[model samples]
Target chain A: MKCGYSYDELTAYFDGELPREEQSKLRQHLGCCGECASALEELRFVRSAVLSAWQAEIQAPEDLRSNVLGRLREEGAFRESLPVKTPVATGKGWKGFKGWGAAAAASALLVAGASWAWLAGNVDNAPLNTALIENKPAITEHIPPDKEVKEVTEKEPDGTAGGSATDNQPGDKPGIKNQGTAVTSPEKPGTPRQTDNAPQQTATGAIALKDYTGKAFLSVDKKSYSGYFQLTDNWRNYDSLDQKIKLTAAGYNAALAGSFKDSGGVVTINVPTASYNALYEDLKGLLSAGGIVKGSDTTVESIESQYKVVQTELEKVREEYEASAGDMEKQNQLANRQNSLIDQMEDLEQRARISTIAIKL
Target chain B: MGDLKTDVLIERCRQGSEAAFSELIQIYQNRVYTICFQLTGNSEDAKDLAQETFIRLYGALPGFRGQSAFTTWLYRIIHNLWANELRKRKNKQTISLNAPIHTEEGEIDRTPADEKSNPEQLIEAGEERKLIWTAIDTLNQEQRTVLVLRELHGYSYEEIARGLGWSPGTVKSRLNRARLHLKEQLLKLGVKPDKESQKDADIRKKVKQL
Candidate 1:
């Protein structure tokens, strides 16, 4: 019942937290004591102002409720979109079919000999046989008898000494024998020389195989299906066998053109094969070693299969070259065409290298 | 009016009636929003907190035991949620409650209207409010809670003590300190102390009693 209270007691009294007896006493004191009473009054006024200010209503924007509802709906939809128990498959699985088709195409090229192979697969198949036959006669007619004679001797490395009768004591016209030999040479070219220097001589003629001993330059013109291969040696005056080997190294599969003396020991082989398979293999190996295989599979089989397909296509081009006119112009054209195909094949090989399989690598 | 019929409406909402929930919102939205606005000191936050309170109420309706008044339970939830939010923000090193409040759509609109009031009057009123709010903000978390319940929400001291799990004496002491702080703030705001003001307040109380 004190008239003069502490600041703490005054605060308690203002908040109505004083005990009943204390509250009555404080009220009685406030009725008489002006200072305590006024202090309590000012506190009440402050409380009122604070309460009113704090209780001031806030008007929410018109769009808030709708926006919240919309967000909730969107959240629901997003949750629903997540993949549940079932797995979803997209496009049809045509990968297997495409792979089979590629293999089949490669096989078909191999079945057809070089002459008809390129033309049959890529160009008109109908006129390919006729073109082959026409080029066949010209190749037979233009090839020198000496060149054939050298081939015959080269084929028989063991028969090189005693095969003089087949060459000199020829009673039958050499032309007829040459024609028969020419037709049969492709079927079985006597002993297929493993080494280009090994001489291959047929019964009708001596065709010495030249060795690619020196630096052999293999040039692939992908725009043209022809690759130019040349062998340069130190000796200028070489034998027919050396010349033939150099030409073969150039990828020349044609009947031998007579060996001509050039200034240097440079033996140029204008092999009219559509592409250089051995060079392709070397390049393919280099690419694979450099880690360039397309798709995910960089396996040996994948690289080899890709190279084989390219080789088959190149052989087809070579056949087309032989089946066409055997003139230098036709040969050059075929070489150019084959070079282009080879370029495309190389690009595809590169694509295959850097594809999904390469990613794994 | 008729015991506010809130319990009946809440029961209807529990029975999966959307209309009943909407009616409930209409009935208590203002009070809930006022409570949030008072706590947050911004309309946008108030609306957000209020809406959240109702949404939580709806979700927890099945579990509501109805041991207490619906509004009291809801106020408790809102207070707890706001306290948690404040604590979270504090932990994040962002304690500026007076930073311009943004609407849910990220628009700022908190400047009080001037209307016909003179600049001096407006500023005085604004400063007084700011001072009191700042003092409230300075209270210990529990003191602030007890003060808000007793003074702002007008809950009885016993109710506040029960709600906050504090003894009545603790609640009284905390409220006393809070009010003293508020009075000192008002004195700094230049509100003149007058004994006649207490008699006026007593007369208003007596008339209400009559």
Candidate 2:
């Protein structure tokens, strides 16, 4: 459009967009070059046309303001902040905001009760040989001379071995499939012999124990197995039931750990041997009230020597701490290490002493 | 500087004043509607986009710290939303509503002809306006956007560059090219020859002033 400059430059010049020197040059070019001047005129004319055509105001739809506000309302912006006062909230049903209030109140009352006898038989984390050594004096009275403790076998309500919700993990063998009938039925004959569990430690190395004649088999298992029960609720009222059972387990000196599954209605937990015997009746009655006890079955698992190794390591660390003779940092490390080993041993022993009861809803 | 009234309204809206937000929407609704309508060229689509802009603004208003004029922030929203909508159907066959709808694969006027008994009323519009709109449709999104912002909405070159996230040089060049391209299209339409003589006295007066 110009002598050497392009139309874009001419357009820029028309709009007063060029630098001062470029503007002066373009102004001089326009005064001399008719072609460049005409090109700038064309740019102005067309741009003015576009301006006129597009500048006319298009009226907005009348309801647009209300519609925007209405959409925000529809998105629940207004309702989200308000406490949802539905019938469930008002009635204090077990699943709503009001229900939570009621639950909190109930839990407060229960905590105030503090009924668990945790000190009477704090046996879950008793020292490794405490039971074998302390209870050995009583073992000869009831246990057979040759019979060793067998691992507890777990059975679901449907009479399936290890098929209960508690036994879902592989190789998690539990005791006594038909032991419900055996325990409930007092006349079931029994001959005391060593359990065919194929002891991991030989008879020489295993805890030398005078096996209690059938008296030690108070649980759903044949052996005086570890006191872990994986109790699950088949009933719909599992949350409260779970909380209640946990409180009951703690009240009676039991270590309970398991979440209540929503769908399958399963809860796995541990109750110490003493606590199990104490709460078994009350637990059965509580669950039976909810109609979940019928589907509940206990599976006791055999305790392995993992705890023994931890205890041995802990003892060695303690001896090292004593020999270090006030090497405070090394002693601190050894003390920390010793505490960690003791904790692991306690956790293992607790697991070993509890019965796993899986209740199927 | 931003509008003081709008700033006050924004402050109250951030403080959870619903009525203030509603006032803000009412104040700016026409500008938003016009921008969306000009871009979309359809009343129904424009209405939807205008309302949608306000709904988005309702959600975004709390975050507006007034870094720029509310109108600039508002325009950015319109531009982004319009660009996304254009990109969604950009690759598809564009609807030439005057053309037949049926084809092997192309954009069809889903708005059936029977819906509008007098569809030719659109053609009966000013030929210059029609030509201008057609030429605008031909531009890539950036050129058309910058051209519209500069020529129609009166945004400064710097403002458009900031809003579009382009350098000032890029905005200026694209706007120039858009005008040149529009001029070419206008020439091919043979509109200048027929009307230039009558309007020349007026356009020439405006041009000399420019």
> In order, how many clashes per candidate?
58, 30
TM-score (chain A) of candidate 1?
0.20
Q: Which candidate leads the pack in DockQ?
A: 2
Docking class of 2: incorrect
Give per-residue lDDT, candidate 1, residue A75.
Answer: 14
How accurate locally is residue B26 in candidate 1, as Cα lDDT from 0 to 100?
66
Query: Interface RMSD values for the candidates, listed in order?
Result: 26.8, 17.7
Q: What is the per-residue lDDT of model 1 for residues A75-115, given as tens digits with 9 covering 90 to 100?
A: 11111111122222111111212343355333321110111
DockQ (C-alpha) of model 1? 0.05
lDDT of 2 at B48: 69
TM-score for each candidate, following the candidate numbering: 0.39, 0.42
lDDT of 2 by residue, B112-162 (tens): 324545434443446445545555555565666777667666567777776
Q: What share of the true interface contacts does each candidate keep?
A: 0.13, 0.36
